[model samples]
Target chain A: MLKITNLHANIEDKEILKGINLEINPGEVHAIMGPNGSGKSTLSSVIAGKEEYEMTEGEIIFEGGDLTELDPEERSHKGIFLSFQYPVEIPGVSVTNFMKASLNAHRKANGQEDMPANEMLKMIREKSELLEMDRKFLSRSLNQGFSGGEKKRNEIFQMAMLNPKLAILDETDSGLDIDALKIVANGVNKLKSKDNAVLVITHYQRLLDYIVPDFVHVMLDGKIVKSGTKELAYELEERGYDWIKQEQL
Target chain B: MELKDKLISSFLAFEEAFDVDSDIHEVRSNAIKEFESLGFPSKKEEDWKYTSLNTVLKHDYSVFPKKEDALEYRDIKKYLIHDIDTYKLVFIDGIYSSHLSETTHDKIDVCLMSSALSKSKYKPIIDAYFNKIVPKNGLNSLNTAFSKEGAFIHIHKNKLADKPIQIVNFSTGNESALMVQPRNLIVVDENSQAQIIERHQSLTDHPVFTNSVTEIFAGKRAIVDYYKIQNDRASASLIDNTFVEQQEESVCSMHTFSFGGKLTRNNLNFYQRGERCDSTMKGITIIEDKQHVDHNTLVHHIFPNCESHQDYKGIFDENSTGVFNGKVLVEKEAQKINAFQSNNNILLDDKATINSKPQLEIFADDVKCSHGCTIGQLDEESLFYLRARGIPLKEARALLMYAFANNVLESVRIPELKKRITSQIALKLGVSLGFDL
Candidate 1:
């Protein structure tokens, strides 16, 4: 469902992601473990079409179409979702309103009529319950004054609402407690399907235990150094990225 | 007569007709002389640098007479409150229209200044507070010098009114340039509470100007919520000044929503005189297509332990201009005062402009005061977030702008007024943001 060939990106002349090659098929989960400043987040951001990063080299293909040329919204309409490392707090915009706008935008892009308000409300209620989010949270301003765990769960709730084809979870488990991590993982697990893919990017291997991945890639110094099965995540977590750095050297 | 000559003649006519008494006639005359000295400010004036009042000043305008045009109550029935059983006051062309107004509460007295001019019971209150806070300079003095008729509302001591009072001021023209000055004085006595909604509208599409001044006094422990809605015609020019004075432990909240006008200026001043007094001022202006809106707010904390907050936002599109100047003053004795002021604006077009200045003048130590202003466009990330969800770009922009202005509208306490303003704001966003409603 996704392909990257020597993807090189940078911000303001500083190279972040250099020659990153990865491939993911449908119904598969991939975990990218990297140390700090190792371009793990940059790779996800470049794929999500964040304009801050300049693509210096290479290309990305999503679902057989060139993804590098698409705008962020277009990529989003193509079912690409990025759970931000730090969710933005948009004041005065309610969660339900934000979700409805996003969903309707995607539908409009795909030439579909907007979902009826009643149906949307029902869907939100069901998904919010699944994510263990209070209905009142939907009425409050989007992510304003929300706790870290609540924000992560809200991101998962939005993912469930949009039902993207590719869900990229970036540090979703960083600020979450054990209960929140399980709830978020459970939400992701429920949304897993044969035609969709999940990319979990994390610094710790604990998140991998809840949402087991089919493949794990160790990233160091702006490049993916090794690719293996889920066992690699445990190995890296036990021994730390210092061993990976030595191997790269 | 030439344009300038006609303007001078109009000023002289107002100066001749003004009823100046012994106590304040000197002050009023001095104000009139000052008005004559300064004349109508052109674009050259520092304060009128961005806003050109030449259209209003150069026009051969006449004042609307008190009994010239007869308008019925049904002409403005759409804006009246049918559900709430309360006092209704009507003013046409700045003159109090007794035929269109109705009052129910005995303790709450609502009467026209014309009637009060003849009666003795409310004469002292009217004389004491009328045109008291409006300074003798520039547009305010001109308004006072040319003022014709208005309403006087006095809530008796300790009288808790059951329903909010509604004031609807309408300006009508007969295909000629005309000016209407509506002066109001509202005094809420000790331990009293009330809500007032002041609505201004135009009866004709022709060019009409309304210069209004309202002075409010909230007594000890009194609470008052004042809302001003300006939805005039595109050809109308509005200059509204509202001054609120709070006594010991009194609370005052003012919300001004400016949605239409060729050029509109709102001056809101709050004086926190007594200890533990609280004041909040919020306003939102949505201007498009050559329109200009200016909001100047000042919150003065004179006593100790007073708190004040001011938030104003503007959305300008299609060569429109918005100006916001918010000032918070904490006196030397006003220690432990908490004052915050913020003004933010969004410019949707390259030609659209916004000038926001937050001024903090604190003379006391151990006071918390902060003021800041932000001028920018819509967030690109948030826009992308919405568009990615399948909402079109136009709808997404409108939604974001609506959310931006919703911060101010949510502070309105009256549900009906809040909903009405919200729908109006939505319509404005739809029109300005190019989204189909």
Candidate 2:
């Protein structure tokens, strides 16, 4: 479902992602665990077409289409989603309005008519209940004055609403409590299907305990250094990233 | 050079052509003398530093005659409130049109000040409050000396008005530059309460200039809520001056929204004279293209134990410019007075400009007063967050801009007026954010 070859990216002439090559198939879950400066977040941002990162070399292909050439909205219309580390707080727009705009934009790009308001409202209610979000939450401004856990859950709620083909969870577990982690993990698990893929990016194994990965890749200094089963996450948590660095050296 | 001489001679011609009443003639003569002494304020004047009155002074604009042309009411239906009936007062080209105005309430008295001045019952009220609140400055002097006609509204003592009062000012001319000055004096008697909505609109696409002055007096323990909506034509220029005074334990509040105009200036002054009185002032301006909107507010706390609060915000796009100046003063005996003021602005384009100054002068040390101002662009991180959620960049920008300006709009209490202002603001944002509304 996704492929990256020799991905070299920089921000303002400072190299962040040196050389990265990765591939993931449909129905597969891949976990990329790295320390603070390992370019983990940069990878997600570059793939999502953030304007800050300058792609110097290499290309990204999603579902047999060149993803590097698309704008952020085009990438989104092509079913690429990035759960931000810190979700933005848009002051005047209600969550329902934002969700409807996004859904309609995607639907229009996919040659489908706009969703009816009644059906959209019904779908939002069901999803809010599933995510344990209050109905009033949809009426308030988008993420304005929201708690950390609430923002994370709202991100997951939006993901459920959009139902993208490829989901990249970037540091989604950094601010979640135990209960929120479970709820988010449950939402992801419930949405899993044979035709979609999930890439969980984190530095700790705590989130892995809830949504286990089919393959685990340890990333250090902008390159994937090792690949193993889910047990590798537990091993890294026990021994820390230093053991991986020593092995690479 | 010819245009400048023509503009100056035009004012001189108006002085000789019009015949004023004996008592008002003296006032107009004095005002004309004052205006000539000050001439037109240039950039040299500290108060007019950022805004230049050169364009207005250089243009040879014509003054509306006493009975030159008839005016029609075309778009008056859109501003009517459904829930509450109101006494409608209409003014066209600065002249009150009684034929087009209607009033059903018995307690409320609505009449043209020119006509009311002739009546013995309203003479004292007009003499006491007319031109009393505005300072004897060049701008105010020009408005007083050249005003064609105005409205006079008086609420009886201890009367709680069940309906609001609406004042509609319209300007109509074809290809001819016309100047209209409509003055309004409102007095809510002791223990009375009322609401007023003042709307300024233009009928033709011709270049029109409107200089309006409204003075309000909230009597002892009375309450007044006032709103000023300026939706003039794109070719029109407006300079609106509003003065509000409060008596003992009375309350006065004003909300000014500027949506369309070539160049708009709103001067708002609130004076808390009586003890234990309070006042609130809020304003919002949305500018695009070469439009310039300047808002100047002053709140004076003369008596003891009075309070005031002010908040103004502006959103500028294209090559537009906005200016905000807020001043709060606490007198010597005004101890325990609490006043706060803030001015914030957002610039959406690289060339858009904003100049904000929040001034506070306190003679009483025990008073609690604070003032601040901020000018900035949209948050980049917030923009990225919205884009990541599948929202296009343009839509994301519109959402953030709407949120930033919503704080001022939420303070408007009247539902119909609030909705109108909100929709107008939304339309401007849609254009600035590169979205088709």
Candidate 3:
């Protein structure tokens, strides 16, 4: 469903993703494990079309189409969602209003009519219930003063609402506790289907314990050096990344 | 002739209609003398440092239009909050439009300033509060001298107005260039409450200059909410000077929404005479093109245990310029006072300019005073976050700006006015909010 071949990317002339090749098929959950500054987030940012990162040489094909020239909103309308590590705090815009605007924008891009208010509310209620969110939480300003777990859960809530084709969870497990992690993982697992895919980028395997991945990749120094199954995540957790770096050397 | 010289001659011609030996005439004489000494403020003055009147002053604006132009209510109904019940004091070319006005005198006095100045019953109030709180300034004196027709609102003790008051002044471009001065006086006695909305609109692209002064007195335990809607044409300019005084346990709030105009200068001041009074000054300015808007506010806490809050947000795009000067003062005897001031701005383009200054003078040893000023661009990361969620760039930027100005709009007590301002904000941002406020 998604393909990245030799994705060489840089931020301000400093190469972050040197050379990387990865692919994920439909219904496959791929977990990318790496240490800090290993280009895992860079790969996701480049896929989502962040403007700061320049693609010196690479090709990212999504659903048999090149995504290099599309703007971020265009990429979003094409069903690619990035659950940020740190969601921005947009004060005075409630979660419900933000989602409505977003969903209507998507519809407008697709030449579809605006979703009815009843259907919109119904969808919000269902998705928020899946993430175990309070009704009051949906009325608060988007991510403003939200706890880490709440923000992460809110991200998954948005994921559930949009139901993107390729979802990238960038460090979704960092600030989550055991309970929130289970809720988030369970939500992702429930949303998984044969026509969609998820790319999970995380440092630890605790989240992987709940949402098992079909393939696990170890990224070291801007390159994916090892590819294995879910067992590789456990092995990395048991033995630190240093052993992997040593092996790569 | 210069515009200043023309105004002096217009003042002489305007005074001929009234009795020259009356008490009101004496006040007008004193005000004109003050204006003659101080013709107009220049950039050299500290208070007018960032905003210059050179361009707006260059027009040979007629002090008074010779012909009284009439307008159909349907054409200008959108300018007023007509959806709600209000006592409207409407004007066309500085002349009172009685056909378009809804004045009342049964329980409260919601009528014209001309009648209030000439009538016998309102003379006591005119003598008491007229020009009482206004500090000596060229613009205020100029407006005071030419003050003939505006809104006059007075609420008695222990009485509540049946509805809100709306003062809307419209210029019809009858004169090649027109200049109007509107004076409003509001006195809410003890245990009374009132809501007022003021607006200045030019129907056409006539170079209209409006110099307006409003004096508001809030009595003990009175609640006063006032809003100013300034969205004039590109050829219009406005100088609004509002002075308010609060008694014991009074609550007074001012919300100024300046969206469009060639130039607008608002001087708003609040003085607390008794303890436990609260003053709120909130403003939102969104302007593009060559529009300029300035907000100058002061909150003086004289008695102990009073509080004041000032929050001003400005968004300047294109070559628009904005200025905010917020001042707060707490007297030595006013202990346990809390004064907070915040000015935040976003310059969309590189050429857009904003000059923000917060001046706090606290003489009380036990007062808490804090002020903060911020000038920055919209966060790119935040913008990306919104755009990534499928919201277009234009709508996303508008949403962010609306969010930035939303907190100030939250304090708007009038529901209709709040919704109107929200819609205006959306319109100014050139996007649809897609939902009700």
Candidate 4:
């Protein structure tokens, strides 16, 4: 469903992603495990078309089209979703309204009319209920004064509402508690279909236990060094990332 | 001839047309003398440093419109809060339009300023509160010298106004260049309540200059809410001077919304005379193109235990410019005063400019006064976040700007008025935000 060829990204004078390439097929779950400053987040951001990062020498093909020339919104309309590590707080926009706008934007891009008011409300109620979100949570300003758990849950909630073709979870497990982790994982698992894919980027294997990945890739420096099955995640969790560097050397 | 000299010469004709034998002649003569001495405020003055009036002043504005042009309600209904029942004091080319007005004297006085200033029955109220708190500023003096007609509202003691009052002045553009000075007087008796909405609109593209003055007197325990809507065409310029007086336990608040205009200058001042008075001044200015808006405010706490709040926000796009000068003064005897002033601005493009200055002078040893000012661009990460959610770039920006300016509407006591302001903001941002609650 997604392809990255010779992805070389840079921010300003420094090169972040030296040379990286990865592919994820539909109906499969892929996990990229890396340490701090290993370009894990940069890869996710570049795939999502962040303007600050310069794609020095790379072409991202999503759904058989080049995403390098597409804007973030255009990529979004083409079914790409990025769950941010730190969500921005918009003081006056309610989460429910935000969801409605997002959903309608995608519809508009496809030359479709906005979802009916009652249908939109029903979808919001169903999605928020699935994520164990309080109805009151949908009325408050978007991410304003929300707890860490609530912010992460809200991100997952947006992912569910948009239902994009490719879901990139960047550090989604950073601020989630055990209960929130379970709920988030359950939500992601339910939304996963044969036509869509999920890419989980994290440093810990704790989340992999919930939403087990089909393939595990160990990323170091700026490239993928090793590829293994789900068992590789458990082994790395036990031995730590230093073992990967030793094995590479 | 120069606009200033033209206005001075026109004062004689204005006096000859109006009641020269009336009691307000002395006041008018003195005000014209002040305008003659001060001329028009220049950029050399500290108060007018960031704003220049040279372009708007060069127009040979007809000091008095030659004819009173009639307008159909349907043509101008869009400019008013027409959804609700309001006491409308409508003016066409600075002349009172009786057919378009709904003035009343039942329990509360929602009428015209000409009647209040000329009728003997209202002489007592006029003699007591007419221009009592107005200061001697150049534009203010010009407004006073030519003060003729506007809305005059009076709520009886312990009475509540039946409905909101709307004062709208429409320039017909019948003349080549028209100038109007609308004088408004609002006096709420002790323990009364009132809400007033004022707007200045130009019907055509002809250049219209309006110098307006409003004086609001809030008696003891009275509550007064005032709204000024400055949404005019690029061919229109406005100068508004509003003075408010609050007594013991009274509350007076004014909110100015400037969405479109060539140039607009608001000189708003408040004086707290008794203890525990609450004064609020808030504004939101969103102007694109070469439009300009200036907000100059002052809150003087003369009595002890008084409180004042000021929150002004602006969004300047394209080549628009904005200025905010807010001052809070606490007298020596005014102990335990709480005065807070905050000014925040966002410049969308590089050419857009905003000059914000928050001044606080505290003479009392025991007072809490804080002022803050910020000018910057929208958050890039926030923009990216919204864009990533499938919202287009323009819609994302408009949403953010709407969110930034929505909090000021929270204090609007009327639901219909709040909704009107909300939609007006969306219109200004060029987006139908659909902020339905």
Give the alpha carbon lDDT tens digit for every residue of A85-141 in model 4: 999998878999888888888898999988898999999999998899999999999
lDDT per residue (tens digit) for residues A194-225 in model 3: 99999999999999999899999999889999
Model 1 chain B lDDT-worst window of ten: B428-437
Q: Is candidate 1 or candidate 2 better by DockQ?
A: 2
- What proportion of the real contacts between chains A and B does each prediction keep? 0.41, 0.58, 0.80, 0.77
* CAPRI class of candidate 1: acceptable
Global CA lDDT computed for model 3: 0.92
B154-176 in candidate 2: lDDT tens per residue? 88799876777788877767437
In candidate 3 chain A, where is summed lDDT lowest over 10 consecutive residues? A240-249
* Pairs in steric clash, model 3: none
TM-score of every prediction relative to native: 0.90, 0.93, 0.98, 0.98
DockQ, candidate 1, vs. native dimer: 0.34
- By DockQ, the best candidate is 3
Root-mean-square deviation (CA) per prediction: 3.4, 2.9, 1.3, 1.5
Off-target runs (Cα >4 Å) in candidate 3 are B433-437
Assess the local accuracy of residue A37 in candidate 3 as a C-alpha lDDT between 0 and 100. 90
For every prediction, compared with the true complex, DockQ reads 0.34, 0.49, 0.77, 0.68
Off by over 4 Å in 2: B1-22, B66-85, B431-437
As for candidate 4, its clashing pairs are none
What's the candidate order when arranged by decreasing TM-score?
A: 3, 4, 2, 1
Which segments of candidate 4 are over 4 A away from where they belong? B432-437
Indicate the residue-level lDDT of A204 in model 4.
97
Interface RMSD of each: 3.9, 3.4, 1.2, 1.8
